[model samples]
Target: MRTSYKNITGLGSAHKGVGHFIKQRVSAIALLILVPLFLFQFLASFTTGYSGVMAWLGSPFGAAVTFLIVSAMVVHMRLGLQIAIEDYFGGAIRTVALLLNSFIALMLWLIALYALIKISFGG
Candidate 1:
């Protein structure tokens, strides 16, 4: 009886509980570690100018770090925005907002990855 009601309404359940929360927290942790590494490299790149910056990005280690930073950053952004949209919006608006949030995050990640790969390969 109780189980049937829960299945019908999709409420009073612990199914998939805190999965999104855990993911967001994990991504935040990754960014906390990666941001300082990025800042240090970025700041030092300023001294050497454009070519130097490109060179750093072109290297394997630099490219990998930058990739990780961008990946984590985008995931965190998407998760955060998703929570906001889900909390504030409803019905069609919530659906649309969620879709847009995902699309924007995907685009940002793709653009950054493309540029990073291009620079790494001297293109």
Candidate 2:
């Protein structure tokens, strides 16, 4: 039996790469569907005035779908960035990049959620 350097050094595959791959694929598919739906809704609302747009966003279905799209988008963005950083970076630089990636994603998510909530509540 032969042991590769990776195995010997306990640096073999993370055993979770497949999970990240699967998540990225799933998120991509989700975005594919959600983006069209969102665009349709958004463009449709443009013909309406501010009150009408607010009304549309306040609807339960609209709120839910918007939330879904935002959440999926943030997740997809984060996962993609994480993969790119991991592939192109190393050591402390990698750590900082990943952390910054996550922070940016988190901030975007929070901002999105805040807007969604405000719209949904007519605030």
Candidate 3:
């Protein structure tokens, strides 16, 4: 094969298969952890009501973890949707779909970050 400036990951080569698989599996594991953690948090909120929910969200560690959750979720969503778009859509529609997904993802991440900051700062 001819050598080029492009990285293996960029060219989608199998050379770095081990690291890629590890990262993919770790992210999947994180999703499993984050999902139930978030749901449990919300259920606890249901027990305590709005202010309790806010307080939990507003706590220092809570905010930090929330940020991490958002970051991981966005990464996971991007990966999932990328494959979906590539597999399902074609031509201009594929491009549009990918662009739309990217925009939506960024918006969601920003919203989560904003909420985290607001609660963390007691706003």
Candidate 4:
């Protein structure tokens, strides 16, 4: 059997929306784990200078973690912005918001991927 709950707009079940929230929360937790590591790395970069920083990033393990952290960040941003758009914007604004979100997400992914590769491949 199936049941439905009326949203404020009274259109469909609310359960569909829960995954969005869950995904966002998962990303948030991931970020919480990454933030300290990222900050510490950034601080170390300053201490060690460019060559040292690049050397650290150039490591296989460093490259892998960087890729994972950046990818998760982009996914997190998408979910958050999607929720905001759907919550407040309507009609054309919502469409525009979605387009912008997609663009930003892709940009982040590309930049992060490039950085990860450069770090992994030695330059």
Candidate 2 wrongly placed segments (more than 4 Å): 1-17
Worst 10 residues of 3 by lDDT: 5-14
Which runs in model 4 stand beyond 4 Å of their true positions?
A: 1-17
Count backbone clashes in candidate 1.
0
The best-first sequence of candidates by TM-score reads 1, 2, 4, 3
Question: Candidate 2 or 3, higher lDDT?
Answer: 2
Error of 2 at 44 (Å): 0.2
Q: Give, for candidate 1, the lowest lDDT window spanning 10 residues.
A: 3-12
Give the TM-score of each candidate: 0.85, 0.80, 0.77, 0.78
lDDT of 2 by residue, 1-123 (tens): 898766666545764435777888898999899999989998898789897778778888788778889889999999999988999999999999999999999999899889879887667
Give the per-residue Cα lDDT of candidate 3 at 112.
Answer: 92
- Candidate 4's C-alpha lDDT? 0.81
- Whole-model alpha-carbon lDDT for candidate 2: 0.86
Shift of residue 109 alpha carbon in model 2, Å: 1.2
Give the local distance difference test score of model 1.
Answer: 0.90
